[model samples]
Target chain A: MNLRFQATKARTSSLVLVSPALVLLGLLFFYPILLLFFTTLEGENIGNYAQVVNSGTSMQVFLNTLRIAAIVTVVDLVLAYPLAIYISRLSPAGKAIALFLVLIPLWTSQLVRTYAWMVLLGRQGPINNMLIWLGVIDAPIRLANSEFAVVAGMTHILLPYMLLPIYNSVSKIDNSLFDAARGLGAGAFSTFTRVLVPLSIQGVLAGVSLVLVLSLGVFIMPALLGGGRVPVIALLIEQQAGSFLNWAMAGTLSAILMVIVMITFLIIKFATRMFVRGRIDVAST
Target chain B: MPDLRNTSALKLESIRKTFGRVDALTSINLEVNAGEFLTILGPSGSGKTTLLRLIAGFVTPDSGRLAIFGKDMTMASAGKREIGMVFQHYALFPHLTVLENVMFPLEMRKHSRRDAADKASAALAAVRLDAFGDRYPKQLSGGQQQRVALARAVVFEPKLLLLDEPFSALDRRLRESMQREVKQLQASLNLTTIFITHDQEEALVMSDRIAVIDRGTIQQLGTPNEIYYHPRSITVAQFIGESNILEGTETPEGLRTSSGMLLRRASPSTSGRVLVRPEAIRITREPATGGATNQFKGKIASRTFVGGFTIYQVDVYGGDTLTVRCLADEGSMFEASQEVNLSIREADCRPVPQDAKDAGA
Candidate 1:
């Protein structure tokens, strides 16, 4: 009875410790997801799901989402890995400054930042004006409302999400591991591949997973920058719910997106499991 | 290329390393002969590890040359140095299996995966861990992990093996036994090794010669007997082992102690120090005991019995302390506070340049 009472006390405090995050996830995330799935089953709108998938515009939007997400995730990983590695070499003060600058974009709303790209990449924006002045081009280059602009805007917002986790993971690595690799007859390239990259894979998985998942739901960047050219699932869902008053179709599309996000996450989770377990086995023996 | 295992012939010429403003190693020079176990003996913060790093090529010397078999490798990468090293923490990869860890060097040599695995298995067997080939480093005992480290280092048959206090993490008994095992292995393989240690007794047991380092400089480098019995510095005497010391004063015959005792003659500098070996000092309880060069009297200050021996500290005049070793079988006839006479041969009481402390400890 005494042991059970102690166990109950421990459980209660642990629950209390995580209560705020649990409440937020339940209210803002889980409840909305449940509501979305429930609304898709409403009796009158069964054919609405078929309408979106069958539409030429909706099919294009769906493919665009996968394409853009892949491109952005790859870019994020490539750009972030080098930056994270460079940051790992910095002193504490230097690292703090770099991270502060990297995360500064996160302090602002994504919508406002994407709109700022409007002023910069617009027809008469400084970039085109400079090009015209240099006689590089006779006319204002069409920079805004393109797939390239949308990718740029989304990558700008999501880069920190990729870099910070990788940076944290790289920093925790035992610096002596590098020295050990060198001592074991490994050159610079071999050491980086065998030791640095493999050790920091956990960070890569996390950063890429989060960025890929977040990119799936990015509607504002495509809407503002793609100029109706870069259709994506998020934009289709928005149109179905708002202008079409077809909430059921919207819910169905949301469910499909949710399934994809979960599957991607599960793949990532499995990979991370392999890594953590591999580490544990190595440690015990 | 000549075999590194068969010969020593290592030189660190004017090696220097600076971490910012702090000098980790400064103009350090050392040479070890072939087929010898030379221990770089120093206290922590004495740049001993840094010196190892420079030789291993993990850290480039700011200004110096590291030569193995008299071949200049100062600008060479760590892989190019081809020296085997055992880290203090063992630094075994926590992700790879034991065999995989051992196979890493072969893989670096561009050996096929199958060949690397075969070599790794052989290396594990050499460490007497054949059954543990599939296990990871963490699963092994501390002693076993040390063995795996040893096998991994020598698996490639590199000639210059460097050990950075590899046994410091093991228990005392395990350390001594491992020392014997490593010494036999080195002798059998004829591997030239530069071992670093802070323990004087360990150095005495292992190295053919010892370089006693202090404050980033070599105070003295010689055979264990030469360094112990004929230390040129006060620091060497204290660092090497325990000592009984008295201030030195010049005498007509040679150097004298504070007690007006004339000790044996030794090379004298204008400013000199005297050193002596404890084994050189003779202690006897019988009053008629004579024939030794010098004699003194004291009560047993303390007596502690080791399993095979009894160590007696005799408190002599002028507050000098003398340690007397009596074999277990010989039996200690004196108890604490018992009056005893101590005698040492004049030859054994050879004065150091000064009484760096005492003639005999």
Candidate 2:
């Protein structure tokens, strides 16, 4: 009885300690979201949602957002996994330097980095000048103001998020497992594909979902690097609210994007839980 | 199964390894006979694990020739060498079931799925874990997980087996039982095995021949009885079991102890240390009136009861302390500070050379 009473007392104290943060979250985050939902429903009916979904241009924008996000996520995974593996195997000093290099771009403002990409991919830039000087092309190629440039910029920015989680998972693997696998007659590639990859899948899934979700809502990279060639949901919402002065349409689009992101998060959570439940139980021993 | 034509399972010629400035293995040359159990016994940082890793092909020696079954494997990768190893942590695949873990080697060898499952089941049955095929490794006890590892190691029938302190995590009773199980399994399969551990008792109990190692070198390699009864140097004598070492100089008659006591022995040797096993020293309250050659009058300073035997610390007349082991059921017990007579035969006093370089080499 005394133990239960002390447990309830501790719980109450913890609740009191967290109440201030809860109130701030309620006022700043939840309140704005509630107001946005109400505003979307105020001057709009259910037809607004249908119009946004059925309109060919708006539908193309949503599909383009999904396609760009998927492309960037795949490219990030392919580049980041090998880099994370390399970093995880380095000496302490080398590891520190590698991690610093991966994280340095994250410290810079995204707009600044996107603008830097603009300079690199512009006409008469170093790449085109070098290509023209090498006589590989008759004229300077158009590199900027395209979907490829936007993907390249976003991939460069979001790579560290993918790298760190995979590094964490790979480094946590016991070194002896590799030796044991080899001792059991497994070759180098067999050990990696059969043992190392499966063990680090949790981190791979996490990095993939994080990059995918973040890429879906990317604003600055498409805005600056795409040069009005790329049309995404976030850019469309900005145009609807600021340029067109259509508040209901902007609110409806924002709500749809928010719903897509939430669904992505829920799907990732469900997939991760199902994938790791058995392995985690075995690893705990 | 091991190759029958090759008499030696493994041969190490001048195997030497150095880490930074410290010599991990100074110079090691050993031959493991086919179908024999050899244990490398030592304290921590004694190069026992280093030697095992070298044999398993995980470590490349600085300068040496390693042969398995008369085939030179000095430059071979670990996967190319047909060997099985049980790690100190069991190293079971946490993502796989018990049956899948045992079938891993067979699958790697490109066996059919049905064949792999059948062999895995048979291997698990050998370790008496047949009922736990579907359970994951985390669901098993430490001992059970280790048994699963053992099954996985032997499922593919590697030429040799390496065990690196496989039972150090279990309780005493569990460790003993597992030791017996492994020994029986090894003998039944006639497998050439190399086990490494720091526990002297476990080495003596399980190994056919125990190699006592210290400071990256083998101090003595012999049977358990030879190691316990006849050690080569002071280091081996002190490491293998409890003993009383008396430093003395050789004389024309026998040995003259540093404490000014002249002890008579069968052989007259030079200045060295003598190792007297504690159990060999007979203790009595009355003075000896028999034909015993070596006798000393002492006072019991302390007594420690270790279940079956009582170890008494005796202070001799010349200020040298000696330990005497008496059985617990010896009818009478001597109290502290009681005068006692300790006697030993001349054959029981073995001479050990005092090597100054062997202290921490």
Candidate 3:
């Protein structure tokens, strides 16, 4: 009986210690989400949700958002994996310099970085001028204000997110394992594929999930670089709220985006759990 | 007909390796016969691990010729050298099951999956870990993990095996048992193995022949008995066991210490150190009555009972304080400040030449 009472007293004290942060979160985060939900029901009916779910254009925008996020994720991973591996193999001073370069862009405002990409990809920019000089093209082409421009800008902006996690995971592996693999008759290629890749998979998954989720809800880079040529869910929601002044419709779109984010998170979590469980099963059997 | 049974498994001719400013291994010339278990014994940073890495092809010597089975392998990569290595930390792949870890080398050599699994099972059975083939390395105890490492190393049947202090993490009893198991397994497979360790007792218990290393050089190489009883240098004598080193000059009669104590020993050198093991000196309360060879009268400065033997630091009259060990069942125990007579025969005192350069100074 005394032990149970002691355990209850410990639990009550911990709850009291954490109550301040919990109250702050309730007011700042949860209250706004609750307000957003009630505003979506402004007409005292589910008409706004029904309109978004039934509209072909809104559904097309949703699919476009997923496609763009996927493309961005693939591009980020292809560029990040090898770069992270290279940075991990550098000396201490070299690693510091390399990581500093990777993080320098994050210090600048995202809007400013997007405008920089706009200048590079403009029709009369250096990229097009160089193409003309090399005789690869007769005239400057439409490089900016397209889906390709959005992807390029987003990839440049979000690369460090993909690189840092994988680098951390790869650097934490025991180096003796590589020597052990090589001493056991594995050549360089086999050793890397069998040892390095499987051990650093956790980092790969973390980077991929972070990049994918961030890309899905991105707004500024796509809105500026795409110049109305491309439309993602965030851009559509902004148009509904700012241009049309349709608060209920905007709230409904935001709710849908929030649901998609939650689903994306669940899918990634489920996939990772399944992957780890599968490995455990293979080991046990 | 030439004898085929005497082929050398490995030969290192004048192997010398150096880091940027450090000499890791200097002028190492050694050979191992087929199926021989040779241990490189040294203190830390003594270049024993460097020598093993050189043999395993992880280190390229600055100058030398390394041959395995009479074939030169000086420029070969680690994977092409056909040497199995067990790291001090066991280094079992954390993601791989015990059976899969053993099967890795076989798979790398292009064996079929079924064949690799079968051979891995057999190897696991050899180490008596067949029942644990499904467990990951982290799930096993330290001893079990070491056994898995041993099984994985030998499964591929490499020409030479190198073990880098494989049992330093286990408890004393478990270390002894693992030592016996590894020795038996090596013998049964007839594997030419080179084991490295800093523990002198482990080296003596496990190695067929030991190479005592000091500061990038092999100080002595011989059987355990020769190393224990007849160390040629003062460095080897002091490192291998507890001893009372009496520094003196050799006269026509015997060795005469600076403090006027004469010890009986035949020596070719003008001046050297004589090693008398603590247990070799006979300590008694009565004085010598017969042919007194090298006898001294001393008072016990301190007594330490170490279960098997009682150690006494005896301050001899006008000479060095010598450590003497007496067995527990010696019928009498001397207390502190008790006068005792210590006697040692001439054969028990081995003269060790002073090395030209002190190692690891």
Candidate 4:
């Protein structure tokens, strides 16, 4: 009886200790979101949401955002997987060097990295100069302010996110499994597809979801590389808040993007839960 | 590639492997007979696992010739060699069900799904795991997982099966049962198997022939009895079981011990050490007479009860300390500090060459 009372008292004290952080988070983060939601509903009522949905330019911008995010996620996956595998198989010194290369870009500011791509993709940049010097083209080509430029920039920025997780999972795998698979009469391709790829699926899922969600909310890459040609949801929200001073429309757009991000989070969580469950079927034999 | 000879299932000629500067295996020449259970026994870092990996095609020898079933497989890839291996850790695919793991080899060979499933089920049943086909590897016990690995390896009926200390992870009772199960499985299938282990008792219990390996080479390769009773060197005798080694010079009758006691030998040799098994020596209160050619007086220094036997450490009157194992008969107990005579048959003492001793050191 005394133990039960002490346990309850301990639980109450733990809760009291954690309540300050909870209250701080609620006040600093969630309270602002609640205020933003209310501001969207003020005066305009449902018309702001209707405007976000019905505006053809807004619709195209939303679709273009999804398209660019999807392309960036795919391009990052394709580029990161082989590089992650290569890094996972390297010698100790080689692995250190490879991981250093993957991480050095991340230490730089995201804006600076995006602008560096701008310098490289410009008509007067070294790429165009090289093309002309090689006689591949008679004139410097227009490479900046394009969707391709935005994707290239974003893929470069998000690649380490994809590569690190995949590298972690790949490195965790026992090399003996590869030997066992090959010893079981599996060719190199068969061993990789049947054994290595399936085992690393969780890492792939984590990386893809991270890249996808981050891509959806991307602002700087599109702003700097797209140069207003590739306006996405974040840019639309920026225009409503900054140039137009339409706070209601901006809040409504912000609420929609938040909902989309939340839905993506839910889908990814559900998919990961399913995949993990499938991987470990703990049944009594 | 030349055709393999019918008599030998696997052959290794002058196999040498070096890792940067360290020699993992050197001058490893051996031939495994068809359907024979050959065990490579050694302590850790003794090149047993290296030899096994070489046979499995996981590690290529720096210089050697390897042939399987009359075909030269020196440069063949692991998949092309048609060899099966059960790794020390089992190495079952965590994401795959037991049935799928067993069916992997068949699937790789392009068998139809239905056919592969049927064969995999048969293999699982053989390992007594038919009902657990749908379960993942983590669901099974260590012994069950090992059996699953064994089933996966043998499902394709490869030319050779290599087991790399597969039972080292299990507890004592489970290890013994799994050893028996694997030996029985190997016999029933008539499969050629090369098993690697550091456990001497397991090698004696499971192998048709045992190769005692150390320092990147095979020290001795023979039948279990040959390895135990007639070890080629003092190192082999010491590694395989308990032995008391008496260093001495050769005399007319036998070996002259450093302490001046003469130990009789069936065939006299110039100079070497004599290895005497502890159990081979007989201890008595008075000097033992007749048929036994060598006798010494000693006082018991200590006694240890080891379940079935009482090991007595006897300090001989001359200089050497001899360990004598006596069967645990309560009535025949010898107390510490009691003087006793130790008698050993002349033929039982083995003379180990000085060069082999130096090589072992």
- Prediction 1 TM-score vs. true: 0.87
- After superposing candidate 3, which stretches have Cα over 4 Å from the reference? A41-56, A86-107, A119-149, A278-285, B1-6, B356-361
Better of 1 and 3 by lDDT: 3
Question: How high is the lDDT of residue A207 in model 2?
Answer: 93
> In candidate 3, what are the lDDT values of residues A1-285, reduced to their tens digit?
699999999999999999999999999999998998899999657988999989999999999999999999999999999999899889999999999999999899999999998899898899999999999999999989999999999998899999999999889878888889999989889987899888887788888889998999999988999999899999999999999998888989999999998898888787777656636665665
Q: B74-150, model 3: which lDDT tens digit per residue?
A: 88999888888899999998878899999999999999999999999999999999999888888889999999999
Whole-model lDDT per candidate = 0.82, 0.89, 0.89, 0.89
Clashes of each: 20, 0, 0, 3
DockQ of each: 0.56, 0.67, 0.53, 0.71
Off by over 4 Å in 2: A2-18, A91-101, A119-144, A280-285, B1-6, B354-360
* RMSD (Å) of each candidate, 1 decimal: 4.4, 3.1, 3.5, 2.4
Best by TM-score: 4
Candidate 2 lDDT over residue span A108-164, tens digit each: 999999988888888878888889899999898888999989999999999988888
Q: Please, what are the lDDT tens digits per residue for candidate 1 over residues A1-285?
A: 599999999999999999999999999999998998889978856665677668787777777898999999999999999999999999899999999999889999988899899988999898889999999999998899999999999898999999999998999887767877887788889888898888898899999999999999998899999999888899888998999988888898998888889999999999898877877565454
Worst 10-residue lDDT window, candidate 3 chain B = B1-10
True contacts kept of each: 0.74, 0.83, 0.72, 0.92
Give Cα distance to truth, residue B201, candidate 2, Å.
1.2
Tens-place lDDT digits, model 1, residues B11-70: 777778898987787667888887889999999988888888888887788887778887
lDDT of 4 at B146: 97
Clashing pairs in 4: B3-B70, B4-B70, B4-B71
TM-score of each model's chain B = 0.88, 0.95, 0.95, 0.95
